[model samples]
Target: MREHRGVPPILTVVAILVLGLTLSATAPAAVAAPTGKPGDVVRSTEITDRPEARMASAARVFDVTYLSADPRGRLVEVKGSVSLPKKAPGPGGWRILAWNHSTMGLGDSCTITDSLGKDKRGSRDKWLGQWLRDDYVIAATEYQGIGGPGVHAYLDGPVAGKNTLDMVRAARTVVKKYVGTDTSNAFVSFGGSQGGHASMWSNSLAKSYAPELKNAATIAHSVPTGLSDYFAAIRPGFPNVVVPDYVTYFSYVLAGLKVSRPDIDVDSYLTPLGRTVIKNAQRLCYAESGPATKGLTVGQLVSRPLADGPLLPALRQYTRLPTSGYGAPILLQQGYLDVVAFTPLTGQFVSRLRSNGVNVTYRTYPTQLHGLSTAQTLEAVKWANTRTTWPR
Candidate 1:
């Protein structure tokens, strides 16, 4: 009697079938497995088929997303570019040049790859072209967070060092796929400004972090070794008038430290206007942010003097140069006339390195500005090439 009141068997069957189909369509998809170990290529796309006329020797260029790690060893995705030589690899394979770029900004838009050949400064293009012409495979890291997720870690030495080393590991994958499997395990690290900091850190980290990498040598130019010294040097004159560019640089350092050290409250030390400008600067590239802070003095930017704030201690911790643990020879290049990374401070850092038993070849360029150290590109390439071949 109860069944008689219910729907007929045929209709009941149809309803059951419809419900099953809907469930199947709405079911959650299975999660994908982790790709592989660090240095594994997550994916790569050929962004450019031919190089710029200036890079005639470069066969192809690729934009790559690869697996790396943050300072805490959490898995992170890093984006970078690789340029292969037009000529085929020799029996010994191609040697790698890991180019750690200087400070562009703390934003994703500041990724060096975005303006590889089109940089208004043209310095990068010229430098890279020269490397390619010399038949060295160039692998340039945009650095963690520059074109990837999270905040650009600015001057965090370990993070920068790891990114530099991981780029070389990822470059090996590219070489095996496109160039040849005969690629040399030997590589060199070099950079200037923030990049110089990274280059030094990479060499220091190589033995501990990536023992497999044959880091032949390291070259750092116009290096910013200590932020505390830099801050003291750049403090406003007696009149208290500061270059607006200094304000922009300060903003980058603050923003970077905020991300890397989330436990510290960066906003507590800033004035309301300082907080506003920093927030705006976070979204801008280096070019835009520099001008935005122009004409603003130190007193106008912050409520309390930077030296009196909690930032100094943190800066001191983050700004120290690695005194030991680097295995390769180092070439430190400084500019006598460079006010940005003042010559005197750099000289002191070199002295400390030497005292620590570091084999440092210090070269000072007279009558040159901060950017002039990069003009040693050709000489550095030769230095690295010779070291890789001679191994002394």
Candidate 2:
């Protein structure tokens, strides 16, 4: 028995020890990968290098789409990505934060990703991304038509809100496979510019649309609420950047309200220049289009006595506000020097929401202009983290 008491079989002991440790380490990684998956996720990275892919990657690098029902109660689709804080708990265990991208419809399919690969600063804009890093799952939507099958409704609140709420459901759907329960987590909404409007409107419409997931806090930066007010403020300066925006507005109104007003002569309503401008405007941000369309004169687009015109009145009717109030804790960041989204209109919308008894907090940035204003993501995170349940 060659002294078998001591090192009888070193190889046997090594194999047993190695197998046990390997199993222990690999098991947890697998479970956590599925359940506690980080929110900074994307469907694929192969498309990331292409020009179009680069753009989408730039805007929302972590592009993850999930299945959720549309407002019509049908199984519709949504495209977006989630950003979870490092060392953060899973969605149900911790807070879930959802973000809405500004303009470019729901899917604008804009080429910005969460990775900040292109611009170095990228879409996560320093202040905005830092605030988003607190303790939440930030999900940004590409809205309808921007990336997917349907046409983007632009400022259509009901449709936009429906899409936004559905995105939460979509995210929860993905999260539940790992966490088991859907309603165990809390959610907050945040966005700026057009996103600001969507954030507020979606907050208002969430109670009725998807009452399960409560809205913790909503932050808006110079939100455009009242179409009437927006028009009133800029009508006098139509020849400036406002005219092309007006054209774009009418185009969106036509597209969103097409079902309600089928009689609209979509082609006749658009001038060759209006059509061209609107076509190009759809791809640009407020800042880009503002300066791009500066050359167009007002009289060329809309005639005098704008009220009775074929397009002006129709546009006015399409963008009018509904009487419903957005019920959510809100933080509004208004840029006093914002020329694109007139400050007065944002104030009026805030007034309307506040008067309706909605929980709201409004802040104004006296010197910041439209392009220069930070997304104000810090306040949104702080406000959202305070909510215990949904609809905070």
Clashes of each: 0, 32
C-alpha lDDT values of all predictions: 0.76, 0.55
> Which is the leading candidate under TM-score?
1
Clashing pairs in 1: none
* Candidate 1 lDDT, 260-308, residue by residue in tens: 7776677766777778787776667889986787767555656655576
lDDT of the structure predicted as candidate 1: 0.76
Pick by lDDT: which candidate is best? 1
> What global local distance difference test value does model 2 have?
0.55
Residues 1-392, candidate 2: write the lDDT tens digits.
01245555887799789999998987555422112222212242223343433322122234466443333333344566544344335444545656676655322545233333344446544545553355454556666555554445566565566667766765665544433544334567777766776677678777776777677677777566556544443332364444336544544444454433445544354446655665554555545655666656543443233343454455566555443466567777787887767788778777876677877777777887763344455555655556535422
